[model samples]
Target: MIRVALVGNAGIGSQDHQNSMYRPAFERHPRFELVDTAEEAEVLSIAVPLAERGTAVADAIRAGKHVLADKPLAATLAEATEIERLAAAHGVVVVPAHHQRFGAALRSAIAAVRAGRVGLPWNVQCDFVVAGGDPAPTGELVNFGLYPVDVLRALLGLEVHRVHATGTPDLVTLLLDHEHGVTSTVVCGRVPALRDVPPGGLAVHRYRISGSHGVLAVDARKPALQVRTTDTFGPVWTGPGTVDVLLDVLAAGIAAGRAALGPHDAVQAQRVIEAAQRSMAVGQPVAIGQPVETGE
Candidate 1:
């Protein structure tokens, strides 16, 4: 069994509570064993807030443990870069927990795209908006907007050339130009998920990819089934299943001594978000992949 240590407790892990998706997923998987401490584990899974993620991963890597951290690996691009640097020095792998990509709807959409159902995708639009989440230093762009940024990058396999963003902490829009001549528009908002729908309500997550042949659209909140518990009524298609897939990926990455999804993805997302913030602040488009001035 692959011995693992789970850190954090509120959102993803139950630090103060006894319930966590990671703990139960590991317990149910035959190939995984949950250890009480990072020192005793072969791998570390971090579900802490972004502020604590860098230090926790660094500590685990210094102790010779692989790390699988929740998204937005660090609050800043420099911090994410430093984390990657530390992992390399320690010869440990670090991967982001971008499990949403493995959702059934997204998976099916990706499959269709790869199967030539959407040929030569040129324009892509995505919206990832949900309500009632804590605010961060970087606002919605980093907190939730990174999802669409990562998705566009993963699907197009292109580098971001430019980014333009406008909006408030609760809502933001981004226009991106990629290296491969593809342009993408992403909209992310923070509105109450449980609020009553207005005239034309928007789904929590939506994607539209237009290609040479056809268009691919997905409504992530469209429940295949629903469950009505005593306390709540919610969709049956929430994230645990994808988290299971992520657990397996982490396990395989640990066994192979390399990360299946390395820090590059997280780094790119951070870079784009940083650029978007800059764009929002300056009221202009920001070119990505530019060399940072050392000011020596």
Candidate 2:
């Protein structure tokens, strides 16, 4: 059994109306035991607010605990690099919660695409808007856009080459150019909390992909696809009914042992978001990991 501790997300404050996405998902789950503090656990599940994210993960690493942190692992690429550095130095695994990789609908869509349903995806579009949730403590691009950014990454399987963004932090639109001549347009927004939707819940979340043969698209599908990365996670679908599919990925990773912690989607998402911010500031398309020919 993997011993775990919670660093934040005690109240399930905002974003996604279910408590199961947080600490509640582990209450009776097998091979997983929750402890009272970080010192007592093998891993730290961090869902803290955006500002405290870096500190929380760093502390967890300093304590020799692995980390499963929520999105936007850090506000900027620099901070993300520092976290990576610290994790490497401390010899701990840190996996960011870019859970779209595990969702059933997106996976189905991806499977179809790979099966030649959409032959060589040419263009993509996605929009993610969070209508309410404590007024969003950070920029719309970082806090809300991370999901769609990750979705785009999963669909394209390529790193963003460049980014162009417009509109205020309250409502922003991004144009991302990826490797191999593929591109994705993204929109991220924030409005007042809706009385109808769950507090801090999503108002509009959507995706579309057009390829050489056909098209692929998706929206929110809460269920996680049952996955076993060779020997990573087992049949998680057989677990408790209340476990959020996203958190299920976390549970499986812990169960798989340290080497099972995989991918750096959060850091990649951070890179794209920061590129978008630079685009917004300079009113130009910013190249990621490449210099934009801004011809001063």
Number of the top lDDT candidate: 1
Give Cα-based local distance difference scores for all models: 0.74, 0.70
Stretches off by above 4 angstroms in model 1 are 10-20, 133-138, 193-203, 226-234, 238-240, 291-296
Which regions of candidate 2 fall more than 4 Å away from where they truly are? 9-20, 88-91, 192-195, 221-243, 255-263, 290-296
lDDT of 1 by residue, 1-296 (tens): 98888888643222321144567777888788989987788878787766677777667777888887877677678777777777777888787877667667777787787777889889889988766534445566667777778877766778798999998867899999987688999888767555333211344687898999999888766544677677765555654476687777777777787766777778888888999999999999999875433210
| Predicted structure 2: lDDT | 0.70
TM-score of candidate 1 versus the correct structure, residues matched by position: 0.85
Superposed on all Cα atoms, model 1 deviates from the true structure by an RMSD in Å of: 4.3
Total clashing pairs in model 1: 3
| Predicted candidate 2 versus true structure: per-residue lDDT over 1-296, tens digit per residue | 77878777632235432234646665666656788987789978787766677777777888888887766676567667677777777777787766655556666676776677889998998878877666554666666777788878877788898999999988999998999998889888888876555555666666788999887767653443546575454223332342355555666655654433233566678788888989999999998884222210
The superposed Cα distance between candidate 2 and the true structure at residue 291, in angstroms, equals: 12
